[model samples]
Target: MIIQKVSDAVSIKRSVESGTEEQRSVVKAIIDDVRTRGDEAVKEYTEKFDRTSLSSYLVSAEEVEEAYERVDAELVDIIREAAANIQSFHEKQLHNSWMTTEKNGTILGQKITPLDSVGVYVPGGLAAYPSSVLMNVLPAKVAGVERIVMVSPPGQNGKLPAAVLVAAKEAGVKEIYKVGGAQAIAALAYGTDTIKPVDKIVGPGNIYVALAKREVFGDVDIDMIAGPSEIAILADSTARANEVAADLLSQAEHDERACSVLVTTSETLAEEVASEVLRQLEELPRKEIASKSIQDFGAIYVANSMDEAINTINQLAPEHLEIIVENAMGYIGQIKHAGAIFIGRFSPEPVGDYFAGPNHVLPTNGTARFSSPLNVEDFQKKSSLIVYSEQALRENKDKIAAFARLEGLEAHARAVEERFKS
Candidate 1:
């Protein structure tokens, strides 16, 4: 159904909720088991879920070499080129430690420090993609993380996909494990006999993986409890219906629950894009997935004007937003929420997903309103640097003591007073 007004758009329920309670319980049980049993639990869960038994969980150097042989040389070169682009884009985001000295001898700033290690979870089996390896690993590598550990489910043959291995290797990932699902997340959070615990975990996975991340949040840092992928296209009469339809399908094909939306000022364009979606959906190889997604979560909203369109976009806060209006760049400032805004018609959603330098692991399910796209900062920590001279300390001691005493923190007041006792 096409919505003709903003008020009507509000009433249409979007299926954007997280995992079910039963799924969460199952994930929690697995996590707790792994936390207690370590490799034993991981082995049991891997065999049960992945339908394979593994002697060793680590992806050995021999396996990585064999994976390279199995993959075509051309694909390897493309992954490397993409890696270079990702590295270049993230390099621009690297923040350095800085300190500022004042005349009163107070020095304050922040010290930038990369996490000691990180675990990257790559979805395996049918969902395995080399692009995921590149997107998840490159940022950690760019942030100067020393140890990069990766995990993916082994196939029924008990082997990691060659393309995934090649991508991980190209992205500078040093360690790889055969385990996946909630158990993989568990091993990363609480180290097993073989797998050492990492400081943080980052990547995309299914509902169980999302639940696992949520369960293990405090034990180890996670990128985000990522929801299903989503996209919104803000288009006008000038935008091509075919291009808009293709862009919407790109996200819809990822998952059946993925949201594909179009908010346009032109009702004619809205109807044209909806028809175009149906035409293209028939041609897609993943037509079953894409078609179901469009029928279930897809929407076309006709706004009164461009201002109304922009307002609707902000409310949705889609993981990916494509602005295909007459002056796409000019509308950028009006977009208050969106994980990544793709300006102009040529910049499709996949460009950000695979080729473009921006991280594809983005905030989803209205999270773009507050959170951000995964970047080098996710793999790093910052500590406030404060070096106060005697003069500075004395000058601020009275105020500090007064504030502390007001909060009933006498100990805190006394600590400051002790420094000035002499």
Candidate 2:
């Protein structure tokens, strides 16, 4: 069972901020090795870590076609529908190249351009999920990224999962490699003979992948250092105990470190939900993982009032938040921090995770306080546009020079003054 005391909030926050020194050292070594050795390092690491050897790293066209044949026709249709929903939602986030001219002939705006290419790292092992393929690839595709390079570890059979390959093909991924872990990230950051360097890398992975992303951030942009999945439900007396318990378990099953929190004003509801979570855990296939997550990081806060519950939610700043109280929409304005807010009991987190049209690749580990979910903006680069007419330049040159000189850069001041010379 989860902790009941309010002070457990501190423990929850601490649990999310985890990265050992040994993990960093190992990831750094892998990154440096890949930087120097290129495909050779990648190959060696793939054999050592993934326990699969291959003559070639690239997934062939025949393999992709076979994947389509292998997966069930019904699931294929559902993936296509999910792809359509994702594309529709992300298209709305697309930004147009905009500019404006002032009366003084100064043109200022932003030019939004999509990155040339992006590498998506889909975790293999027990964490492989086809939904991640759709979430990472669709946004880049919608933003007009020309090339989408996908990398995932081969299973024991030396092949990518059929469902994952089918999803990548459905999402318009043109290039794919059967390699994973930190080595794939390094190859993406610094080009290998087989895998060309990409402008940015996106998707979720294990700790090694997360650390590798952190290490190579300066070389190539990354989506975010995503943490374990978490959910915080702010329910009141009206909320159903079983539904809330099931929702909490939804995220808890993601990993042993995943967190599930419930903040409610009703003590009786808390007791009911706690009992339901234990009862339901027995039937889940991933009960061992979920149980460990609950015992370590899960919690329920018995707030005295709705105000206290809102405070608790903001303090936690959970990745996925469910507000099941009365007039859920009415409390939306009051919620200050959360990656995604599921407003009613009917709107569970899975709805957002799958066919709900919103991007499910969200900020985790309380990053919702400042960052945002992955959207079209993540794939697009913005440049400030400034064009000053001769008159405008003449009017502002002295002021610009004065400001530059104040910063002890005489060359900057002189450059502006030289432009006005006779």
Candidate 3:
């Protein structure tokens, strides 16, 4: 990893943008195939990529039961514990539609309604993540979403992961599908004969899935386009270099593209953390991938002060941020952008990923500046209510008419005028 002093590093623009031409073209192709070929296209893509053949895309009830038996009882208990925490946290975000009536017999209020149905995509290849299922489905359930449809790729045996199935059952998912990749996204967006169309889609997948979601966006709502996982650590002289190295490696192990950065004021701490990372990397199971990531996108910066470190962090807007300083609380309000903040050494990023009650699905690649972590609001819509009694309309008609006329919208003025013609 390259080490730079805060003053010497150049200000670089973010890597991801709205949509590149190649991305648009890929998305368009996926959308077109799904639109025209439908189920056939989905099946072909599944066979080609997932290496599994499925007679039916939907997972059967018997399959879910079998999955429970296949998984360890101990892991099942852990999943339930995690689900409860995730549910409790999201339940707090649930909003009720409310209204207020005036003496003039006019009522005005906003209505909060959950989407009728939503599709969640779970990546299923190489590794299975039951934690992702909990993070994605719990919020939708808290928002009272009517139907939760889950889609994941099948293994070589042409079956879903037992842990994934167990998590889905615990999360109250209505349906599970044995499909994955961009094809699964297409099936959800345009609706295969088997998989019903959804109002919105959530969860994470590979580049193909991301591109597919980008393709199907207008037809159905989607969570933010996730980039590679990233984490930034802001540590001081007092911080534990070993712990900082471990946290950085946790994110780097995600993929070769994942970014891990450390911004610290202590040169000694920087050298210690770097040495610790090299030592720990040798012991990691995914050492090859993590090593590549650290050699590439990973960075270590020795800032002049905490303020300079914070400024560098804001510029990066990493997906996960850890503040391991003596006064971590005092710096919380100063963090302007981060997908999630872990204050102090005890609060590692994995805690939030598994059981901390906060949603783990977060914006990536500097999107934290504008977007937010996934929550109940992602599955719900709000509509404004406006009411004007005759007295109220008459009282404000001239003002409204004048405003509309001033904007060259005579028809808008006419609509209000004709309503109160006397």
Q: Number of the top candidate by lDDT?
A: 2
- The candidate, 1 or 2, that scores higher on lDDT is 2
- lDDT of candidate 2 at residue 405, scale 0 to 100: 92
Worst 10 residues of 2 by lDDT: 8-17
Model 3 lDDT on a 0 to 1 scale: 0.90
Once fitted onto the true fold, the runs of candidate 2 whose alpha carbons sit more than 4 angstroms away are 2-14
- The per-prediction CA RMSD against the true structure, in angstroms, equals 1.3, 1.5, 1.8
How big is the positional error of residue 356 in model 2, measured in Å on the Cα after superposition? 0.6
Cα lDDT tens digits for candidate 2, 315-353: 888889999999999999999999999999899999999
Q: What digit string (tens of lDDT, one per residue) describes model 3 on residues 145-205? A: 9999999999989998899999999999869999887778888988878888999999998
Q: What is the lDDT of residue 263 in candidate 2?
A: 94
Give the per-residue Cα lDDT of candidate 1 at 291: 88
Q: What count of clashes does model 1 give?
A: 0
Per-model CA lDDT versus the true structure: 0.90, 0.91, 0.90
Candidate 1 runs further than 4 Å off: 1-3
TM-score of each: 0.97, 0.97, 0.96
